[model samples]
Target: MTTSTTRQPIHTSPINLTFLGTASAQPSSTRNHSALTLRLGSDAWLFDCGEATQHQIQKSAVKMGRIEKIFITHTHGDHIFGLLPLMAACLNGAGGTVDGADDPRTQVNLNDSPMEIYGPLGTRAYIRNGLIYTHTLLGRPYVVHELRFPGDPQDGDFTHLPPHRSESPNGRNIPLKTDLNDTGTWRNIYSDNVLSVSAAPILHSVPCVGYVVNEASVPGKIDPTKYIPDIKRTKTPMSVMRRLQEGEDVELSDGTVLSGPPRRPGRKIVVLGDTYDPSPVASLAQGADLLVHEATNAHLPGIDPATKETDTYESVQERAISRGHSTPQMAGKFATLIDAKKLILNHFSARYPGDDDVNEEARKIMEGIRDMASFEYDGPVLCARDLMSEDVVLQQDNR
Candidate 1:
């Protein structure tokens, strides 16, 4: 007689990040472009989708149907161009019922809901024009909502747009009108039971902002023995159990009182998208479990042979003003100043093939900063790879 075995599905704790397109510009055969996916339990959020971002998603661990939220940093082609393909994939690629599937969570309506998008400005028009032309709305209505920080919307479309420069006084919405109406104000972009997102104004030729997504504070796990029930031994009721777990007073059936919840481990993660060289961004990501910054070029100050003109060089600071880009050094220092737990340099320039130069130069800068920062802030520093996944945990099992 032979016995057969069934493979049980593994449960993975901690959220993960899948790098869809790490390149800063257009998608080449070797590199896709700038796109990232944040996995929060069953929900995945997209941060900037450039050309071929959907392709990258297809090649990675992310399921097109799982991503319900997309947050675009700015409306650059390298950032928002992939919205169509990603949307199509979600419409046609996922949430279909399988014959023998038995996962209990798949029976819910959220399992089939379309994506929810959030961005700076012009996002609604951009998506509507692109999707409407292609007839991309298939089974569900994928909603794209705009995020208006404290200051923005100089055009005075506050309901749909951000605030305005006229609102601040010596201020108002933003400062000038270039990128996001040149408003120098920031806001929290995304949030839920597990995580929260915040935005920061960065220097750029166009309106650009960096995002910071943080893991939310987690409540302590409760001890099952504490909720022990007698008589029928059916255990504690969910409402009373919830209140007790929250460390609040709860009344039992017999008028007995319960208090306190045992504590458990917790962690936080942050991602910094494309922006010019700025210090406040680092502070925004301070004490983060992870920091993903854009490294568009290998910055060394006048070491170029590509183009002899001023338009040829693209540093993190100058690019934000001239061509709107960021260099490796700027990214490294920003992560260092904020004292991030982990620094992940991303958004590579298409100038170098295979992204070899960016890795070498960016590593050197981070190493130098670690030596000079005058704190024992030695932690993991990674150079993100296209279509790769990063598991960001609040605490490691061994730790």
Candidate 2:
């Protein structure tokens, strides 16, 4: 049976990932640009809104309106070409209903809450200029928050034109705190009740950042059997049970104190954009349940297949580093260094087609990349494909 990316009613998993696009600098026949979405409870957070991302979302199960927050690793065209179009669609009430299905979650009503966008320097100018030149007027408002690092572009210099008569204008772009912590991590780029996102500077040709999504720990399960007998014997109010589950010690009339166990730790998901060395974010991504790293190019040990040249691991690594990208082995090494439990390789080169099932050569190439990564990181590694969905199940907290 074919799986679906549609949100299920009963499954309230904290972090669910859907890979919208997995191509690198260029897109291929089967792959679009780089894009992905994480469904955190009711709201969806999008990362790297690449070209044709909206079309990819339409084909997937992710709804449009649920994408409340968008995080851009950089202002590369392949990473953010879809931003303006997506915002326009949100305002025009287009691209909401998939296959003519009427779902309110996919629609953005008039004067709906603004979409918050977080990105590296030059993001504000990109969004502001795109909207202005395109003559686009989103009925709904949106806000862009730029993250500036030292030596990066100066902030608060971009000016927005006065709103057109029919335009839904929003406030000026807000620049986040650029100060880095002791560990060099930008703490709490965004935080809410469900989860928090952090970022760190990464090595790239242009200024780039990687993000870490940490789900909030939840209360541990309460054993009703242990407390039911005490409740009946002491005639204690059942409200005390609620308090106990909330990690509070409650004393009954008979002086019986009930203490809940420690809270269960949530899952950690690390997602990085194109980078040669992503170690800057390693401190924040340690022991991640899922590490989504880029493997843009890999060595295929053969002569005269496509490039008519012999390939070696060292040669490929050197080329990838020069281009500000990562090979499968490099991605694996980083995952192993960070102690990631599972690794999903993404942002593949266009040379390797994404539709592995139909192309035997592509399938072998992808498998070869996975094997190369496994050589460094002794963990499960998956090559991401367009429209692929991953359900991240948090491990049981034995401690």
Candidate 3:
């Protein structure tokens, strides 16, 4: 009897999402403001850095240094007030020195890896002006990339005030796709070997944007037991085996063919800022593993026992839309339109405190919001709270 050799499959880290804050324009005693972190392995990406975001980071498991990129939906104070402070802290080495004390690497290479910040048209002006007016100097270099839509101000048009003495403004402004009318998706804002991020213009009071993070699909695992015998029989090189594992079909001199398995799809996460409508992102965000949408207002009866007044869903929804926000049902409708696997309602109003554990009324209100969203979408719904963490599961293929 011959023994079949088996090889170990490569392991990839799961993407974990942590909500640093889940408040709307006004923050309550429990919820801080709008901020969240998506952690993949050792690195993290921050979305919408609201007020007290750096302080919230201190309370969570996410490290400041690991946040390589920051994405802002708009320039609202509640969504961007924490950016300068966070950058300043990073420059101060609050997370730690770029290189370890005993490590041979030097900090001179810090400029090579500047932190990346992405946002709407005003992002560049906001950061640059903030840095200049506040006199907050970042020790390390940082870059800001603005996403401008059609009809926006052209470069050097003085619509966006230029920053003085800010060395990192590299004129890296990204514009909308010429075929946006047909595709409805913006240009891929950021991409690396592991992950790619894209954005779309959503309906808000200001120029707001929504982001979608897509992890690279990985090569499927191979059954070493089935291929090892053929490889040994045919005297095939180990390099051929590697090629087969990388989704390549290999043919040996003996006319034996080795076929690779199907690739495993990576997780997709859609996160939107304060927007009444986010349908523009549906094309890019379809079939997402997780959808994070704002639920700024909802009609929950008895939420305030003192008043004994119940606001109808239609009435509250009108108010939410007028303010360029979304209700729970509207968020659910968007999730359903995109066929999202899971939905998380965030950016709650201050009226509904997110202290589920400490306050029973708050917990009931949160549950009511989830229920309201569930009415439209059949997926699992979760009401976001401060410091809440969730792991996005990988989508597997049976083949």
Local distance difference test, each candidate: 0.59, 0.79, 0.80
Q: Pick the candidate with the highest lDDT.
A: 3
Candidate 3's TM-score: 0.87
Alpha-carbon shift of residue 245 in model 3 (angstroms): 2.8
Candidate 2 per-residue lDDT over residues 1-399, each given as its tens digit: 011144333123546899999999899989999999998777788999999999999999899988888899998999999988887776563322234335443334435566778888777668777766665545566766666776655546355654332232443333334454355566776665657788888999898989998877767778878787888899987877878776778787899887876677678899898899999899889989999999998887652156436657788789989999999999999999999999999999888889886778778888988999999999999999999999988677522
TM-score of each: 0.66, 0.86, 0.87
Give every collision pair in model 2: none
Once fitted onto the true fold, the runs of candidate 3 whose alpha carbons sit more than 4 angstroms away are 1-11, 93-111, 157-166, 180-182, 225-229, 235-242, 303-310
**Residue ranges of candidate 1 with Cα displaced over 4 Å:** 1-12, 92-114, 149-189, 220-266, 280-283, 299-321, 355-377, 396-399
Between candidates 1 and 2, name the one with more favorable lDDT. Answer: 2
lDDT of 3: 0.80
Worst ten-residue run, lDDT, model 3?
Answer: 1-10
Ranked by lDDT from best down, the candidates are 3, 2, 1
Task: Kindly indicate the candidate among 1 and 3 with the higher TM-score.
Answer: 3
Top candidate by TM-score: 3
lDDT of candidate 3 over 162-186, digit per residue (tens): 5533235554667777673656556
